[model samples]
Target: MRIIKKLGNAFEFFKGTIAINLAVSILPLLFGGLLLFNYSVVSFGFAISLAVKEINSKKEYLFYFNNGLSKGALWFYSWCFNFILLISGIFIFNLINRLF
Candidate 1:
């Protein structure tokens, strides 16, 4: 339950950036970066998204911080959320490639 709530808090960030993040993840494939780097480029995208969010909406985090979610905890949850998303996306892409 605690994990779920942490993830839920993270989702607030993820939901806003999902489209941009997915596009960023795909860009590496377009240039063959994925073959060499193995999806690490997605982390750059995550970092950029987090930076933008923090810059644009620093106040939003206060709600999370007040609710026992520190900056570090929120950042951890966000990273975990993106990592899970990246892995799931790769798995689904590979599965579809196999099917087709």
Candidate 2:
């Protein structure tokens, strides 16, 4: 019975951790995406800064921080992907213009 209780507690902890991580990852991306779409660098910086502050302030909040970080990273990567696409398009446009 004691072992079963311990297992249950451990499982609960694991579940909570997963939930926190997921939440942290999502929140940043949502805000970041909105800011990106609007080309609001100030808002993006503010949002990410707040997230970093929150992550650093509370050790117990580490799970949430990690989740947020994951989301932020995803947002950053997506932005990078878009930037690369734009550059490629510009290069192709220039090449075509020069050729014609």
Count of clashing residue pairs in every prediction: 0, 4
Q: What is the C-alpha local distance difference test score of each model?
A: 0.71, 0.44
Q: Any idea what lDDT model 1 has?
A: 0.71
lDDT for predicted candidate 2 compared with the true structure: 0.44
TM-score of 1: 0.76
Error of 2 at 21 (Å): 27
lDDT of 1 by residue, 1-100 (tens): 9877867876786686656655665666677666532454357666766777788879988988766788777777767777777678679989999999
Alpha-carbon runs more than 4 Å astray in model 1: 1-3, 23-27, 33-41
TM-score of each: 0.76, 0.33
Best by lDDT: 1
lDDT of 2 by residue, 38-68 (tens): 3432244334444554465455345533444
Instruction: Give the Å shift of residue 33 in candidate 1.
Output: 4.6
